[model samples]
Target: MPDIDDFLRNQERIITTRGWAVTHVLPTDDDPDTTAPFAYTVGLTAHDHPELIIAGLPPLVAHTLLNDLARQVYDKAERFSHGQRISDLIAGYDAVIIDGRPTDDLLPGAAIARYGRLRIRLQQIVWPDQQGRFPWDSGYNFDPHIQPMIAHL
Candidate 1:
C-alpha cells in the first residue's frame, strides 16, 4: 500500500493542478468530544490538506471522508474542466471510484463496506492484495469490479 502521505500528496497534486476545491470536517480543540465532530462541517477552498488526514482519523470515518473528498473532485471536474479532456487524470490514478466502487482500483480494503449492507450496496471488491502483496498490476473480479464499469454513465 502506498504510504498515506504519498496518497495524500498525490491527491493534493491532482486537486491543485486541476484547480478544484477540497472540503473536510474537523474538530476544534475547544470541542471536548474529539470523535464525533459532525455537529459542524467545514468546507475549505484552499489547496492544502486538512488536519484530519494528517491527524489520522478513525478508519470508518476516514473512508467516509475520502468518499466525500472524491465526490468533491468529481464535482469540481464538472465545474471547471467540464469540456476539457480528463482521460489523463482518469488513466493516471491506479483506480477510479465509479458508482461507489473503484475500477482499476488498487487501494487496499477500499471496496468493503463497514457501515452498510456491503453485499447489497457494494457490487465488487478489488484491491492490490488480491494479486499478492505489492502486486502493481490491476485485477478485476466479475461481480465487484465489473459492476462499477457497467454502472458508469
Candidate 2:
C-alpha cells in the first residue's frame, strides 16, 4: 500500500493540474466498522464546494462516478442540495444526494488530512439498485450492509 505522504503528494499534484482528485477506499477484513468500500473527491473544497462522495460500489465504479460528477459540478458550477434528486447518473434510476456528515468514519482520510477532520463537508451521491429501489426502499436487491446510509445512520 502507498504511504500517506505519497498519497498526499498525488492528490496535490492532481488537484494542482486538474482541480480535483478521486480517492477510492476499500475496507480491510479486520476493520470492524468499515463494511463497505467508498470513493470521494479530494479537491472540490478549493472551489468552495464540498467534496463529493459515493459508497457501496466497486472501486472503479465509485471512482468513475466521483470523477464524472465532480467534473460536471466544477465545469458547470452546479451545486447539489440535500434531498435533491439527480437523474442523469444512472440511465433510469434516480439518485439522491444526502448531506454526509463529516465524521471520521464517513469522510476520506485524504480529504480530512487536507481539510482537517470535521472541517470538510461531503455530499453523498446515493444510487439506487437495478430495480430503481433505494436503500431505504423495500425489496432493494443488495445486502443491507453493502450500502450503509451514513447520513441517516
Candidate 3:
C-alpha cells in the first residue's frame, strides 16, 4: 500500500498537471477545530477560495481520497462546461429557524448523500474529458517500453 503522504503528493501532482491549483492543510492535534489529519482545499487560485474541500478521516483509505478528489474535479468540469459560475456553485443556503430552533440538519445530510453517490459512480466509471481522453491519461502514450510489457504480460 502506498503511504498516505505519497498518495496525497501524487494527487497534488495530477491536479496541478491538469491546470488546477491545490492548497493542502495539515493541522496539528493541538488545534481544537481539527476534523482530520489532512485536509485539502482545491481551486484555481492561490487564495482561500476553494472549489472543493476534502477532509481525511483517520480510517479513510487512499482510494477513497483519490475518488473524492476526482469526483469533485469531474463535477467542477461539468459545471464549468455548462457555464455555471463558481460563486453559484459554492453558495450556501441561509439557515432558517422554525420555532426558534435550527432546522439545518437535513442540509449536511443531503450533501453527504450526494458525495457518497458521486464516489460510488467515480469508482465504477472512467470519466472522459471533452477530447474523449480519461482524466488520468495525459492524452499520449510517450513511454516506448510500456506497450511491450503489456504484450508480454
Candidate 4:
C-alpha cells in the first residue's frame, strides 16, 4: 500500500495546481474507530462553486490525499433516470488518484450501498481502451460481493 502521507501530498499538489477545493476525513488509530475513516471528497468550479456531498468523512486530522483525482464513475446503466449518481453529487469534482491502491473490502460498505440503489458502478479513473494513451487501465470498481454488507451502512 502507498503511504497515506504521500497520497495526501499528491492531493494537495493537485489542489494547488488545479486550484480546486478539497475536503478530507481522517480516522483514529484503532480499527473501526468510533472516529470515522480517512478519505477525501473534492470538487471544482469556476468561481461560485457549490458544495459537494460525500458520506463518511472522519475528522481532518491526519490522512492521505491523492494528488491525481482517481475517476470514480457512476454508470448510468447501473441506475435509473432521475436517480442519484455519485457524479451528480460531486459534479465537476476530480478525485484523488489512488497510488497504493484501495480494495473493495476496505471501503465503507454502507456508504457504497446507498449508491448501489442507483445501480451505480464505481470505477477507477482510467482512459477508455479507445483513447490509447498509456494503454493502462485506471480506476477500481466495487464488485457484487460488497452488496450484502452495504445494507448495514
Residues 1-153 of candidate 3: C-alpha lDDT, one tens digit per residue: 888678557756765665333333444568644333332233322221123322233324323543454455554643212112232221241111011110121111222232332221111111223344322347723332111110110
Q: Rank the candidates by TM-score, best first.
A: 2, 3, 4, 1
Give lDDT tens digits, candidate 4, residues 1-153: 878677657755765665433444444365453433334333332222211222233234112222223222111112121122233322353222112122433342322332332332222221112233211224323222311111111
Model 1 misplaced stretches (Cα beyond 4 Å):
1-15, 38-153
* Number of the top lDDT candidate: 2
lDDT of 1 by residue, 11-103 (tens): 556556644322333445886443222210122223221211211233354445444444554445322211122223222322222232222
What C-alpha lDDT, on a 0 to 100 scale, does residue 101 get in candidate 3? 10
Indicate the worst ten consecutive residues by lDDT in candidate 4: 144-153
Which candidate ranks first by TM-score, i.e. highest? 2
Where in model 4 is the C-alpha error above 4 Å?
Answer: 1-13, 21-23, 30-32, 41-46, 56-83, 86-153
* Model 3 worst lDDT run, 10 consecutive residues: 94-103
* After superposition, candidate 2 runs with Cα above 4 Å error: 29-34
Lowest-sum lDDT 10-residue window in model 1: 47-56
> Alpha-carbon error at 20 in model 2, in Å?
1.1
Candidate 2 lDDT over 1-153, as tens digits, reads 999789788889999998899988788868945557888898888788889988888898888888888988889999899889988887777889987766544657788888876667889988988888888888989886777665851
TM accuracy, model 3 = 0.26
